[model samples]
Target: MAGIKENWVTGVGFGNFQKAYQIYEKEEMIFRAYVNHAHNEYLELAFEGGVIAAILMALYLFLLLIAFTKIRRDALQKTAFLSVVFLLVHSLADYPLRTAALAMTFAYMNAIIFHRGFAECRNQSPELVEVDHNGDKLFVPVGASP
Candidate 1:
């Protein structure tokens, strides 16, 4: 065990791989974590951050169930499910970062989707509103829009 730790610490045990990535996994992680393409880490971090942010936003949306009148609240629920689906698709399916930037991107996009949804609810007029008729209040019905 100690020898293993020493080997890892010194970066000494790595060797050739049967294929391109088979042997280079650790090196790739290091490269992704440090050196060039440093943006990869940032991108990954941003992806995670975006996930956390989405969760918080979803929580806020769910809290206002009664406020939105039936239709609007249902709409809010659908949007929340959309966000969850986005998170599910991203976290599962095991896609690579370079390949799955699409997922990260979609997560980011969903954040905007929900944010704008929240915003749209806020901007609506009283008569035209369903999920947000309270005005400036959070969680108003989210299904009343035509």
Candidate 2:
């Protein structure tokens, strides 16, 4: 009984590494919370929901493509359009949080492509953005919403 109490007090003696102990405790808490919320048919319902969402997003994209004309001016407009599509897909797939990360990545690539002002881009790093252009100075303005 005493040994069990000591183990409980120190988070099962994984405290030598504080980060590991914290991670273990957090995982334990998450497990407990999930267990408390468990429903036997939840996974089946979630799976069906995901399938429906995928079909819906597909149909939506198909319709949008049908609506686009050759005279359409901006590719950025399409990027924003697809971004919204992916966002709805994310929500319909039951993950509303994932879209933000994906949108950041997609927007970064779009910035490197369109806003960088180059027919052929040269180099990029995790921390630095660079491009090689002939005469055009493509600058994306601050506080610009798209």
Name every residue pair that clashes in candidate 2: none
TM-score, cand. 1: 0.27
What are the clash counts of all predictions, listed in order? 10, 0
Q: What is the C-alpha lDDT profile of model 2 across 38-125, one tens digit per residue?
A: 1222222222334453355467557555544321445665665566556545554354433477658655643433343332222322
By summed lDDT, which 10 consecutive residues of candidate 2 come out lowest? 36-45
lDDT values, one for every candidate: 0.42, 0.40
TM-score, prediction 2: 0.25
Off by over 4 Å in 2: 1-30, 35-46, 49-54, 68-71, 74-76, 85-94, 97-146
Worst 10 residues of 1 by lDDT: 11-20
Query: Which is the leading candidate under TM-score?
Result: 1
| Most lDDT-accurate candidate | 1
